[model samples]
Target chain A: MAGTDKQQDMLAEGPAIILVEPQLGENIGMVARAMANFGLAELRLVAPRDGWPNEKARASASRADHVIDAATVYETPSEAVADLNFVLATTARPRDNFKPVRGPVEAASDLRSRFAGGQKTGIMFGRERWGLTNEEVALADEIVTFPVNPAFASLNIAQAVLLMSYEWIKTGDQAVTPPEQALAPAQKLHIESLMGYLDNVLDERGYFRTEDKKPKMMENLRALFTRPGFTVEELAVLRGVLTSLEKFSPRNPRGSGAPER
Target chain B: MAGTDKQQDMLAEGPAIILVEPQLGENIGMVARAMANFGLAELRLVAPRDGWPNEKARASASRADHVIDAATVYETPSEAVADLNFVLATTARPRDNFKPVRGPVEAASDLRSRFAGGQKTGIMFGRERWGLTNEEVALADEIVTFPVNPAFASLNIAQAVLLMSYEWIKTGDQAVTPPEQALAPAQKLHIESLMGYLDNVLDERGYFRTEDKKPKMMENLRALFTRPGFTVEELAVLRGVLTSLEKFSPRNPRGSGAPER
Candidate 1:
């Protein structure tokens, strides 16, 4: 069995990627790489110009060689998407012969629900020169396109695939309930307390000379410290340094006063 | 008498930054930098923090020293806005106390229109620690807040300043106009046509064939040419080489078939 087939069997739910009349082997490789980024393994190629199993495609796949090795090649789009229950076609230019067009987010959400119900879903991408032809687009249930800068909307093939993959991953079941043991950064309250202690120490040492402006001065200090979003361990270290400074300072009643100025 | 004064004088209308009880010199300096980014020069400090004109503040101001030099110091929020006809306070937390509330875009547009009508408008940013005290928020004619990440809305002082400044600049007369006379790239259409001709000639000569699927041999050739969004000049040089290749080929109709290989 091919590596991609093994990967697909292992997954609880994941979508298939279909490339129709993909002219370049490198682009096919890049699409596989993008698919791997979002954990999608199955890749179906329809009538590639360079033939199947090109070395250039393997090299471009990089860490995703498994995806390239397992890619299935077919003579036409119909054969490629024959098994898919739901399919989405991606294109930049709007077609006059339209199906219901959904943005990336909506398409991802619908696909997620469909996958949850144990239905197979696939997304089709067309050639770089001329995107999916009108006939090819008509085969899909829905059309997908990115909300890009209107004047510069010509996206590289891999970039378009990556965006769609990202949205799908975000909407997937695995994303909803993230792992319980996942570590998050220290909370805001802990950082606030550390800042308060540091300001109090500074105040005790006569660092804040102007009494009327001390409140405003402390606020600015808080802003600077809070911006970095320090962790508990980092805050503890900073507090320790402040404590040591207080003990060593000449202003301390127990320490030597203004030595060798 | 300073650079900021000259800038303010040059612009018949400009946005005023009212910083309420700002605590740190560094943050004040950073706020100045943010203001300068959006062409906002006037800075009003209400009870600033390490006292007015601290050396640390000036150092933090970096290239925005003019904003620091031109800043006006006031003791209270009311005192800060007494001279301004329109005042907008920036706050994150919503309060029950009644006041006209506007989001960043609306607030920026309101300020722009007010300025155009010769009304002096000031935007108030509260102290970082507690934000604007309820009493301080009450002092303003309107309140403005940003549409930030709801889960983590704790924006840095300078970041907040930059966002507001960006909106204000975008809405104001200082908006960047689209460039006139769209200039095409150096290479023109003729060069591209030549490159296409070369590609066809190379294909006919079987330059891309290797120990692979001969039927789909054109894929790798398409990949190379698809890249390098080339101009007309580059294509001409490539075409010249193809012409030389055709002349040298032993299969040329006018020449004796000499096996060059």
Candidate 2:
């Protein structure tokens, strides 16, 4: 059921994943698997070193034969992307060009918006050892790259496919999230009541060192409680914590306040 | 330089990546490569399928010897993540529980914020086939999952690592971007000048058929131009387009406007 064409429509259709001069068939197979995971079915290969119809790619593609079977081959990168209205070339290295260079997230939004307008889009991935040449990148509308450790910037071709494909499905998404984790924000009146209780306890415990500094310290405490607006549950837990501390106060010692049961 | 310890510090240190009862050594190797690409060095393995000191994993790990050689093996999943203060379990399948299940991007933010607070964190990936047991997920503080086609939601162990590692580096990033591609916005006066020129040309071209609807049409045009303010270069191009179109106007024939080219 997962391999059928009918079920493939469950995920949104996305930009093409094009590979230019990919050397190894195993890498091609891995790229197919990556695309399948992200709901991207269209795969384009240009001047593959091992050529099309190779058995190695078939063996490595796991069960994602649909992407590999429908994969198209073209003579040049230009001919491969000629039908695409917009093309973004992926390169690991920075280039000296005026074309917009965006990270994966921003580029995903650009592709998604263009998709909404009914425009066809494609992202080009260059060769394994030698990435896209300047001439080939010139054919693209923009440049899109990845985020890797500058110390070890290398990303295998299959890994690069996974990153871009993952972004293609994630950007511009409005999917339902898991069950709500946060409760409603605490009301100002409720928070002020808790603050007053805390202030009274702190005064009883001699937490205020100086009379002149009391107002400034209280102002800081108020800001901390109101800064980002904690959830009602969070506020409740905080109040309970202060109430627990009040029982341990020296003025009302917990060990002496209650006799041994 | 890219592989040395001194160079590793170029990227910020992130959470440990823990694999629980992984089945394949090659998959383990690929995970190391993915983590190294994103500047994460800590790796912990819990009861690997073939036990410790496996040759297949080493062969698959590329040249990320720092991560592969230093990996520590533990007896159980609990022992593997015992030292970490915050833990996230990665799973493709959902469970009927209250644990917050976050998408990769949001989970990345959660991890990074805790990182800012100096709390140690780790993310656990389960067996290649079975994924995490409910009991194993119970050990984690939250759950993190990927964006994949629900029809074909399977992600190979290595591919899953690549997606999470990519997000680990991207979230909360303050890295330098490539040279800016956009020019400054056009001054309001300059934009209005081009708008006037465009109105004149459209009037000469009889673009407005009804006088009553003209105001609404022009109002739409004004909003279109100002809604997302165009840049100076954009305004210049718009004016030039109108100037070029003015020549072909039927009212002012370019055929007899001046000398022929």
Most accurate candidate by TM-score: 2
lDDT of 1 by residue, A1-261 (tens): 255445443432377888888887777877776666566677888898888888788876755766787789988776676566567889886665536678776888878866765557789898887888765675566788765423223455665676676567657544433222422324445555665687777888787898977865665565455444354677778877776666665554344664222
Q: After superposition, how far is residue B237 of candidate 2 from its true place, in Å?
A: 71
The TM-scores of all predictions, comma-separated, are 0.35, 0.65
- Writing each residue's lDDT as its tens digit, candidate 2 over B168-243 gives 8886464423423444344445545665777787887689887877765665565456444366677778776667
Pairs clashing within candidate 2: none
In model 2, state the lDDT of residue A139: 59
Model no. 2, DockQ: 0.49
Clashes of 2: 0
Question: What pairs collide in candidate 1?
Answer: A50-B219, A216-B23, A217-B23, A217-B49, A220-B23, A220-B24, B191-B232
DockQ, all models: 0.01, 0.49
